[model samples]
Target: MKKMFAVTALVSAFSFSNVAMADEDIGCGLGTMVFDGKSGKVHKVLAATTNGTSGNQTFGITFGTLGCDGTGTITSSQKLAMFIDGNMDNLARDIAKGEGETLATLSEVWGIQDADKIAFNAVAQENFATIFASENVTSTEVLVNLNDLIAQNEALASYRI
Candidate 1:
């Protein structure tokens, strides 16, 4: 019984840690909006469960209801950061090349219009060294650097997160 309890506790700890480290927010939904300012394990769990069980989160994301933006698209920087984190290698390569599927997808994620894609790609390729400053550069650092680069460019300024 003691061994079983220990194992369960270990699993629970891992689960909680993963959730705590999640890049995205609880998400836009009725439950999330209702519990927005509340902080605590219990409130978080309740909000998450309510969003998941009621399926309101999906509904909100799709229809842009509740606190969700009406674009039916990824409107959160956290989600964009998560995407960059997951695709760092591909993004680095794409950015370095000035054009690729990953880079194009990232532009889309940033809501960059087709007219500005050339400028966006050009800026990314030109500032590859700055964006990926070091071999150990992290996703957050990459995002910051990329945003800074975008801000410096008049054509790409509006796309800066």
Candidate 2:
């Protein structure tokens, strides 16, 4: 009796959750594809359960399969932040020197074309003190300062992410 009651409670919870969620709340997964366009509590619960248990959601997110957008994992700004965080020392050195592979990579990350890379590098070199600003400046601070500097540069303003 107790086991049956627990099962009933769990099912009830799932049903209530279905009501609370929007119609498209199941998200992209094998379950969503399987139960596409279906409605009601039972279908919602089954779809939710399948998506949660099968690990297809993880696969979908990683590989851009199962109707998931490939670009959902990280925004462009996030990519810039991660790159800056990982390559801070190299970036600083390159910025200070006004040219290096890392600095070139940074320009690429901002989608600056080859034609404008010279201006980008020049801006970075010219504003190195403003970008670094302090001995303990953080990656986030560096990104903000870099974006600000880029925005101020007429040739590289469009490249600011």
Candidate 3:
């Protein structure tokens, strides 16, 4: 199960995530239509299709673009949450080690800004056990817990996305 999730995360990262760059600007900012504007079923389908072609879609999503413009499937935050859940063990290990592919991949998946990244990683490294303490934790739960951790700490507040 764990391996399966890890594989899934890798697949998602390679196929859907625009990890190479850190910029927040994305195509037409249309992804925002899903959450901020009027996004009916038709709009959602159009956005998803546009997002597919737009390599930077996830960037807009993580920064509150809601890439797909739909409640169906998963949102960018949900995808990041699941990626973290699936890779928590490796993440903890990498955080403990201070560097690894796991950490790098997660950085991209979470879309942690370059400016806020070190602090965020440090927080994750410090709170690894608390953040990933349970195998039964859902993606949403992980998100809340992580955001809460960021909220409580001044230095990590930049991670709240």
Candidate 4:
């Protein structure tokens, strides 16, 4: 239908506009990585945290990935944080698996490197998310390597597009 076609075109235009407006390279340079469509200037990233304490016995962890675009350049970096309350090993495993998988996928998409992954920082903090609050949990940070991401792109150039 003509109406349907018009709506689709409008939606496509809006989607591209939003993508163009997104903060370049989120979760990288700044203290707190900006989430998609978040409107705010990020001058400096002083600190960050991620905690997963939903219930006394329930198991879950808060995970976040931040990337930032270098000033006036395409160069960027990313920091990933995961907060765990149940088992430390479980948390590590989750990061190695769940978060790791996502990071790898993102690296390929964003042209990041594997060796660039590093523990950014960690600190104990008290986080109160409505009913669930964590008092003594350490927030860990992980950085993504940009060079490796580029190599991946080079290797997979043919498959891309």
The candidate scoring highest on TM-score is 1
- Report the Cα lDDT for candidate 3: 0.60
The CA lDDT of each predicted structure is: 0.75, 0.76, 0.60, 0.29
- Candidate 4 stretches greater than 4 Å from native: 2-4, 12-20, 24-91, 94-140, 144-161
lDDT of 3 by residue, 1-161 (tens): 99879845644544464433211222233343333344466665565455556443554445433333222466667677767756866866887766688887877777777887777778877886677668656545666777788879887665565
Query: What TM-score fits each model?
Result: 0.57, 0.56, 0.46, 0.20
Give the winner by lDDT. 2
> After best superposition, candidate 4 residue 155: deviation in angstroms?
27
Model 2 per-residue lDDT tens digits across residues 34-137 = 67678887897788677667576676556555554446466687788878877999999999999999999988887889999898889889999999999878
Q: What lDDT is reached at residue 104 by model 2? A: 97
Q: Which stretches of candidate 2 lie over 4 Å from their true place?
A: 1-72
**Candidate 3 backbone collisions, by pair:** none
lDDT of 4 by residue, 20-76 (tens): 222322233112322344544343222222111212111111111123222433233
Q: Is candidate 1 or candidate 3 better by lDDT?
A: 1
Which regions in candidate 1 have their CA more than 4 angstroms from the true location? Answer: 1-75
lDDT of 3 at 122: 83
